[model samples]
Target: MTQRTDVVVIGGGQAGLAAGYHLRRLGIEHVILDAQTAPGGAWQHTWDSLHLFSPAQYSSLPGRLMPAQPGQTHPDARHVVEYLAEYEKRYELPVQRGVWVDAVHRDGTCLRVASDSGEWQARAVIGATGTWTRPFIPAVPGRREFSGRQLHTVQYKSPAEFAGLRVIVVGGGNSGAQIAADLASVAELTWVTRRPPRYLADDIDGRALFDAATARRQALDAGHGDTGGVASLGDIVAVPPVRSARDAGLLPAKPMFTRLTSTAVEWADGTLAEADAVVWCTGFRPALAHFASLRLRGTRGHIATVGTRTVDDPRIHLLGYGDWTGPASATLIGVGRPARDAAREIASLLSG
Candidate 1:
């Protein structure tokens, strides 16, 4: 027999948990299904040596603040995962761990969701899975033929692991810069960006840059955008962008790479760089393929919609998509707004 619920959440991350909490507050019943043995999806898969660029004050899930001293940096991967685990216990959220959802289909008034554990029939379904379900590694020609250790930035942890080795760090985004910088001291590092990245220092002291970026990202996503790139708010304000890093000879400012041969990377300008390992920080993609019926509005992976409502299906919603450019958009702040709205929408459908 298929168990039933008012709604079924596809993920158990911050988005899913927040949605579930809101549903409960409205007296709506829902179940959270997650594949991981525990909560914190990205954090569970993230490398050991990582910290949120955003500070503790800004990274709270929803109701609880990330416990920390005022100036302490935001929690690391371990701290995040532990905090999420504690969050589950605190609210008694009805989450089924280790239940990987395989497919979802509409069944009359309710949606049928099949998972590893069993099946669920729900009046509505929230795709709170977030955007990082799939890693977006670019297709470099002859990549398969390369014999060296090719790894995605998602699995990377520390620079010590690649110490004394020649490594090619691909992509110009935050991950690429941070990783390349960290590895430079220990390894022979070469940084390659498709284009120059606009780096912003958060505060004058440079200690709170992550928080600043998160704030900007949040604003942009909320549609109340600000001057793009980066802004430093407190402490030391206005530090140079990463272009200065290039000028200072801390990194190489090579043009975009043409292609990757089995043993070397060909630059756009007729140059070959040898590498023992290539760290592709190409970014992430949304795994919307699982829901075959949810149509995307445009060529972009984004599902075009009016506000938080999906254009294809009002019952489905996406949050934390890169669309929000303000500080809270990318970070955990203000996510509660969309999740709460989504939960209310689902409850309304169920009540009707």
Candidate 2:
């Protein structure tokens, strides 16, 4: 038997929870289907050393603020997981754990969400499955011949295992920097980037970046020219650990290499450097494979979205994919506004 609902939120992560919050506020019937056996979403899969770039105050969902721990400046992955678990419990959100959504397609006036557990016929669907599962590693020449340990950031756990070895950390993003910093204490680390790493001012954190992005978005929406001085979240925030690493002269990065040798990496200048391992922190792609059957993907394999609603399928909405779906929707605080807007839209559509 197919269960029917007003909405079906895929992936019970931060974005999904936020969407559920708004849907509940509007008295809308909805169910969240989570692939994980428990709560926490991607936070449960993060590296042991990972910590939020923002403080607890700035890293919160729509209704409740993440609780702050005394003397703890930033929340760690475990802390975030605990908070997410508690948030779901507090709201009494209807979440079906371990229900993996396989595909979603239009079924007459409703959408059919097929999952391992069951199927849901919903008036609207929200895809909040964020990018953690789809880690992106750029192809490099001779990569297949490399004998040394090669892993993406998704598989990284602790630096302790890499002790006394030569490690190469690839990519210039915050993950690359943070992982490289973590490895420096136990290993000889080399940071590689396609371009020079951009570091934001030490005083700036995720809060400031979010505010700046919000202001920039508001200005553009109001028909004003881009007030381009605001810094983006892409620029690394000098968090305490990262700051310490920088002060200790361990945060320097080298230009990207041309190819990978069996036991070493060759630079653009044909210089070879041997390494025991290569950690690729190359970021992620949206986990939208479940929607592939819908054939709604536009340029760059991204679903065309105007505000959270899919341009190709008005009944489907995307949340927390990134800026392409909505401004800063990938972050904790950023997902709320879009979720709210999407829920309101869904409610309006269903009511009509």
Top candidate, metric lDDT: 2
lDDT of 2: 0.89
Model 2: per-residue Cα lDDT over 1-352, one tens digit each: 8999999999999999999999999999999999999899999999998889888999999999999956788999999999999999999999999999999988999899999998999999999999998999888998999999999999999998999998999988789888988998899899998888887888887777767777777888889988553444455777788889989998888999999999999997889889999999999999998999999987767688888999988889999987666677899988899999999999889989
Compose the digit string of candidate 1's lDDT tens values, residues 203-308: 3232244445555656766789574434333211222333344556777646568788787888767688888899988888765565765445468655675545
- Model 2: what TM-score? 0.97
Question: Cα lDDT of all candidates, in order?
Answer: 0.70, 0.89
Residue runs of model 2 more than 4 Å from their true location after superposition: 227-234
- Models 1 onward score TM values of 0.84, 0.97
Ten contiguous residues minimizing lDDT sum, candidate 1: 234-243
